[model samples]
Target: MTEPSVPHAPTAAFIGASWLALVAGAATYLIGLFNAEMALNEKGYYLTLLMYGLFSAVSLQKSVRDRAESISVSGLYFGLCWLSLLLALLLLLIGLWNANLALSEKGFYGMAYLLSLFSSVAVQKNVRDVSLVRQAAPAK
Candidate 1:
């Protein structure tokens, strides 16, 4: 009996982007949990949002994917993700500042601000899978 051939699968950029977003979201949430009192305020929330935006815009949008998907849709997804994070960060900052948090604490939040951004870019854009590459016959 002959073995069946395997079919190729199209890479979905959404999965990669989503994974990055998830990691960033998880990390920020964990960090906040670890330092609840320290993170108790608007600055912490702002930091989270900033990280989100960074992931969405700097990371997701920057990924150069050659998937079987339209560029326009990808761009829209990237834009919306980044915009939402930016708005959230702005609101958090405003709230924290209004609450009169210390400057040093605010600055500390900036440290983890790029975690999402980095993850967004770090996520693999192209997933590897088996493909049938034709090979030339050796000279007889």
Candidate 2:
């Protein structure tokens, strides 16, 4: 019989980089929003999109990981996780496409938003890996 594979903890550098990317992306996006010349409602829209994108990305990552590990994530929930992440991306694209900002500003927001989403997934994976490693370790 094949033995189940053990979870390995992420390296310190990777963990640190993941967290740094998440923080830098999110902070840059939020700071841009704070300084933008847009109306309050417009700012709120971008803020909401960033928050939604982050949550959906993390949720999708967890769902995918659970399924890979043979954990019982329901089909419906899994589908929704995918759908939510896609919807977040779609909404951001639509928002940016129709906004009145200069091309450079639009590019800036798009890059920061994508960076934040990607880093969130990496951070979530690192967190889960660390947790699994800790759980699998024998008690001292």
Candidate 3:
């Protein structure tokens, strides 16, 4: 029989970096939005998208992990998780594409948005992995 896996803690550097990247990306995006020449309504739209993207990304990551581990994940929920992630991305792309901002501003927003999404996923995965590892460990 295969030996049981041990619960290993995440490296301090990885955890710290993941958190830092997430914060930096999100902060940069928001700061850009706050200083943007767009109307308040436009700012609201982008802010909502960011919130939705972060939530959906994390949910998708968790659902994916659950499926990978053979845990029971409902098909509808799983499908919704995927749909939300895609929709969020599509919405961001469309918004950025149609905005009147200069190419540089557009590029900056796009990069920040993508960085935030990617870092959020990484953060979610790291948290989940650490949780599972701890749960598997015997009480000392």
Error of 2 at 50 (Å): 0.6
> What lDDT does model 3 reach?
0.90
Model 2 C-alpha lDDT versus the unseen true structure: 0.93
Task: Give the poorly placed runs of model 2, Cα more than 4 Å off.
Answer: 1-4
**Winner on lDDT (2 vs 3):** 2
Clashing residue pairs in all predictions, respectively, total 0, 0, 0
Candidate 2 residue-wise lDDT, 1-140, digit = tens: 33335677899999999999999999999999999999999999999999999999999999998877777889999999999999999999999999999999999999999999999999999988888788889999
lDDT by residue (1-140, candidate 3, tens digit) is: 33335446778898889999999999999999999999999999999999999999999998887776667789999999999999999999999999999999999998999899999998987887798788887899
By TM-score, the best candidate is 2
Clashing pairs in 3: none
Tens-digit lDDT track of model 1 for 1-140: 33323334434565566566647655764565466565455435555565556555444444333222333336666666667667756755665576544776555444345455445444433232222211222346
Question: What local lDDT does model 1 show for residue 90?
Answer: 71
lDDT of 3 at 52: 99
